[model samples]
Target: MFNGEISASSLQQISPVSFAYIGDAVYELYIRTNFLLPSKKISDYHHKVVEKVRAESQASYLQNLYPLLTEIELNWVRRGRNSVNKSPRRLPLQTYQQATGLETLLGYLYICDRPRLEYLLSQIKIY
Candidate 1:
């Protein structure tokens, strides 16, 4: 398994689904970290984390973040958004697409550049 940095070109060649897979994990962890507090109940924390992890929530986030993304970042988002895939019945297709796009972009940054990923997450209000 790749436990190290991957080249940008190589990363780009990987399937968008693969990117979204890892991106999903990374983003969930990011949200969880911010919500961690001893004072908060486990159930409360779980709910808060779930709120951000939903596809609709991610889609909304992606929409608001367009102006903040760089051209390259936006390109990755577009690549993910355009990927053809079926969505879970609970969420709308557009929301799934946008969420996958955001996740793929996050995974791309997480692999290729940690600083950039941190910078992008920093731009958002994770709470």
Candidate 2:
């Protein structure tokens, strides 16, 4: 959905929060697409995302991704991590923020370049 409209350089104009918003959708879609079981219940699908999208969980994903991310991606993650966003309910503040940062990086890579995004996705060790 993000391949043709905006270039990666121009995406810099987008706020980190905005990136996270889109990133949330992108990652959710990816998770859904990756686990395409026709018999799965909606609750089961949501639980899967809940397991992965939580602050601590996403932070772990970011931790694992550190070695694979490029300098630019790392910069984006730092910026997203440092962004002044709201605290998510029931989650630790820093962890939620870090998750947002991870989401932002995911979103940025997604819109900036799909092939690069796919490459990054390939490196993720999903369970």
Which candidate gets the maximum TM-score versus the true structure? 1
* CA lDDT scores, all candidates in order: 0.87, 0.81
Model 2 scores worst on lDDT over the 10 consecutive residues at 1-10
Model 1 local distance difference test score: 0.87
lDDT of 2 by residue, 22-68 (tens): 88888878877776676688888888877766678888888888998
Off by over 4 Å in 2: 1-9
Query: TM-scores, in order shown?
Result: 0.89, 0.85
Please identify model 1 stretches exceeding 4 Å from their true place: 1-4
